[model samples]
Target: MHTLIASPFLDDHLLLRPGSTQGLRIGERRFKELAAANSPCPPWLVDAVGRRWPDLQLAGRRVDEVVLVRQASPFGYGRASYELNLGCNYDCEHCYLALKKFDGLPWPDRKRLLHVMRDAGVLWLQLTGGEPLIDKLFPDVYRLAYELGMMISVSSNGSRLPNRSILDLLTTLRPYRLTISVYGATAESYDSLTRRPGSFAKFQRGLLAAHEAGLPLNLNLIVTQHNAHEHDAMIDMADRLGLPHHVFSNMSPTIYGGAESLPAQSREYLRKRKPFTGCNAGHTFFHVDPHGQASICKVGRDPQIPLLAEGVDGLARLRSIADKLLLRQGGCTGCGLQGTCGTCMPLVTLYRKANAPLASYCQHGPDRRDQQRR
Candidate 1:
C-alpha cells in the first residue's frame, strides 16, 4: 500500500490519504520537488506528516518508491467520473439511464483510460454506473485506480456490500467514500421501487456489513411517489449510522432526452434550485461514459470526445465545446427569464427536446414554492 498522495489540485497542491479526509496543503516548490521521480523523501515532509505514513520516517526512501506523486497537466482537471459499465442488477422505474445495456472497454483499454485520466491530472475519480459494484472489472478497476493514487468513490445500490470478497476488497484498499442510494425505509416499499424481490433484505445486510467493517459511507435518500411517505424514516435510519445523507426528490429525464423517468417524481417534494451560476464542468471536472466518451458533465454528453481514441489531448477542445453548448442559441434564445433560470442550458435543452411539461423545470409553469413539503 502507498503511504500518501502528493498532487496538484488545480492551481494549488494537496497532500491527502487514500481512505481518510485528513490532508495538508503544500506550496508549489515543495510539490514540484516531491513530484520528481528520483528525489529522496524530504525530511520536512516526513517530520510534518510522518505519523500518517510511519514508514516514510524510517531513514532513506526514494520518493517514487513509497509516495504516489501525480504529474501536472495542461488540462488542469482535478476531478473526473467514469461509468465502469451501464449494466445493473436492479431495474428501477425512475432510472435516468434509459438503456441499461451491459458494455465497456476490455481490461487493457480500461487500464489505458485510467492512465490517461491520471496524466490529465484527475486526482479525484468517481466510479458509477447502472450499478458499478456489479461490473465484472470492478475489483481490478478499483485496485488500479487506487494504486495510481486517485481518491476513488463508488456509487452503488448497496446490495453487494455484504459479499465477503467485496467487503474484503473495500476493507483492504478502502475508498474515499461509498455513496449508496436508499430507495425506501421498508422492504415492501423498497422491493416495489426496485422491482426486485429480496433487494431490500440484501440492502439491509449490506449496510450492516459496511458499518461493521468500519468503511466510510454516506446515503442518498431517493424520494419518488412510491417512497415519499417514508422520507423521514430514511433520514432516521441514516442518522442511526452516524453518516451524512442527502435527499434527491427530483426524477430527471433519461440521458437520451427521453421523459419516461419523470413520471416517478414526487411532485410535493419538488422545489426550486439555486440560480444557474456558471460552473467549471469541462475545465476543473469532466465526466466519462461507459464507452470512454468524455463530456463536459453528465447532463451534457453530446459533442463528447472519444478518450480511447484521442486520449488526453482531446480534452483541449472541451472548454470551447462547453462554451458553445451553454449558449442560449436554440429554443432558449429569446426567453426573457434566461438570466434567472434555475437550470443550466444543457439540462434545459434536454427537457425541451423531450417536450417535457413546463411544470417540471420551468419556473413560470407553477408555484412550487407554495407546495414546499420539507
Candidate 2:
C-alpha cells in the first residue's frame, strides 16, 4: 500500500495506488498516522508530501529504503497550464499571444517536461496555445500526460478537430475537457473576427466532428466590439449543439506589451466593478510557455522563470514574484476607484511601458469621487 501526502494548500490527503489515476482523499490526522508507520509509498507521493510539509519524519526500515526527491516548491501546485505552441491557423483580433513567435519545444523534451510536472503534484494539466491542435506533437504529448494520470484540458479554436485522425485521437484519449473559442455566430461575422475567410466553415466542421465523436466540449464566446452584436447568436449556436458556453469580455494587453483593446468603448464594456483581489496563480496554478518559462498566470506580471533550468526551484521564485506583485502599489493602494478600476498593477505597469494613460483603461475615469460618494 502506498501512502499519500496531504498538501497544506489542500485540506484532505490524497492517497493513491501505484500507477493509478484515481486516489482516495483522507483526513490529515489519518495521513499523519500512515506517514508515521513508514510504509512504502510511491516516490512521487513522498516527494510531494515532503514539499508540502518539510518537518515530516518517517520511521521504520521502509523509510530508509525510500529515496526522497523534490520536483516543485513547498507551495504545491494543483493545476498547471502549458502553451503547447504559439502557432495558429486563424488570426483573431483579441488574441493576446498574437505577436509571440511559434516556439514550441520538441516532442521528446515536451514528454520529459510532462513527467516532471506529474512528479510535482500537478493533477490537472491544461494544454493551450495559439491553438494546441496545430502542434504536430500534441497527440503524443497529450497521450503521455494521460498515461501519467494527469487530467488534461485543451483550449483550441475548433478549426482542426474536424480531421478524422484528430477526432480519433480525441475519442481515444478522452481529455477531461476541451474548450473551443467561438468568435461569432455566422460565417461572415466569424470570418471577419478571425480574419480568415474559411475559418468559420472549419470551426463548424470541427464542432460537428467533436460532437459526433462524443467528446466532452465547452464553448468560450469571446466578446469583442467586433463580435459583441453576435453574442446572443453565439449562445444560440451552443444551445443548438446542446453544449455549455461562457462569455468572456475582458481583454488583456498583447504578449508584446501593447494595449490592443484600449479603446474607450471596449474598455467601458469590459471593465470590472470589483477590486479583483483573489488570484490562485502562484499558489495552486501556474502557466508555462512553449519554451518552458513558467509564470504565475497567463497575464501575470511576474518574471518568467525558465522551468527546465530551475525545475521546481522555479516555483519558489514564482511565489516570491507573486508576493511582490500582489502588494498594492503606486496609485492602486487605497484607491477609492479600485472597485470600478479595470486596470491592475501588472496591467498598469504594462500600460506605463507602452506609454498609454491609465485613464484609457479605467472605466470610472480619473475623478470618480462623486461616483464613489453616490
Candidate 3:
C-alpha cells in the first residue's frame, strides 16, 4: 500500500508507497496559501499528512507512484546514499558539513569509490562536499559515476558556476540534477550569509549558464534569520527560472567538526516538534565517511558504526547493517516527531558532542513549550 506524506519544505505532497517515491503536483499559489493557513501543522494544510494508509490503496488519496521499486532489492534505490565528496567552499552560518569535520573528498580515492558504488548497486549517487566543484577531478568523477550506471546528482553553491570550463564539462556529463543553494535574490542578502561579496550575481549568472548548458537545475534556500522573510522572493526567483524551490527550515546552532569553536546562530523561537520516530537512516539512506565506512546517514559518522567496508559485499553488508538498525532502535530513543523527522549527520554529531546526553542534533534538545501551546 502507498502513502502520501507532506514534505517539510515544499508545498506539494510526497507519495511514499511500497517500492515507489514521487512528488505530487501542486502549483505555487496553492502551495503558499495552504502552507500559510496551515501554520504549525505543516502536514495538515497539505491534506494527506497524518492520514493512515492501507496496505494496498492505489491513486486517488494514494496519489501517483512514478518511481519503480526493485523487487529483488526493494528499497527506493537498491543501495541508499552514495556520498561523493565532503568538501565545500562557502562558509554559511549554518554549514553542518564543515562543523562535522566532513572535509571534501580527495581524487586519490576514485578507484576505491568506483568499486564501492558498483558493488552496492547504488541507484542514486549524490556528490556532495564543501563544494564538489572544488575537487580537481570533478569532471572525471562525473564520468566515473555515469560509467558505473549510477544516476548522478550534485549539490553546489553556484559560486564556481562562472567557470566556463566546468560549465562545458557539465554540459556533456549532464547530471541528473544540479541543486544550487541560493542565499538570497539580492547581492546584500546573498553575500551576507555566504560572507562572499558579489555571490548573488555569480549565482544568477550561473543559473543562466546552467539553463543554456541544458543541465536540470533546482534551487535550495536555507531559511535563516537573514533570509527567511524573503521566502516569497526566493519563490519568485525559482518561478522566473522555472526551477523547483527547496526551502530548509534552519534548525541547528552550528556545524560539526573541531569548528565547534565557532559561534552559534540566534535560533528563531519556534515550536520544535517531537523528534520523528522510526529508523529512517538505514531504512532510507546510508551516509558514508571519507574513510569508506558506512553509518546510518551522517549521524553514524559520530558513533562510528562501520556498516560496510570498501570491498565486495559492501552494499549488501551496508543493507544488512541498516536492517539491524531499523529492526531495533539504535540511537533515537524517545521524543517528539520520532518517525516523521529528517536529520543531517554533521549537525546531529555537533549537537551530540556539545551535549553528550543528546547526540543527534535533529532529535536533540527540548521543544519550545510556548510554540507548541499555540
Query: How high is each candidate's TM-score?
Result: 0.93, 0.78, 0.64
lDDT of 3 by residue, 1-374 (tens): 11222222222223232212234444455444443441232333234432333343333331223222211122333334445556555667667655434454466566566556555445566776667787777787777766554456778888787698988777765666788887776777788877777778877887888877767888887666677667679889889868887776544433354433223232452224444344556544566665566666654553443433435344444545555544323344443444544543344445555553342244333452333455
Per-residue lDDT tens digits for candidate 1, residues 311-349, read 999999999999988887675575666667787889888
| Weakest ten-residue segment in model 3 by summed lDDT | 1-10
Candidate 3 TM-score, true structure as reference: 0.64
Q: State the displacement of the C-alpha of residue 47, model 2, in Å, after optimal TM-score superposition.
A: 31
Best by TM-score: 1
| Candidate number with greatest lDDT | 1
Q: Of models 1 and 3, which has the larger TM-score?
A: 1
Q: Give the per-residue lDDT digits (tens) of candidate 2, residues 70-171.
A: 123345787899999888887777777757467789887787788667766786789999899988898898878776656688899999998888888778
Q: Backbone clashes per model, in order?
A: 0, 0, 26
lDDT of each: 0.87, 0.70, 0.55
Which lDDT value does model 2 have at 265?
A: 27
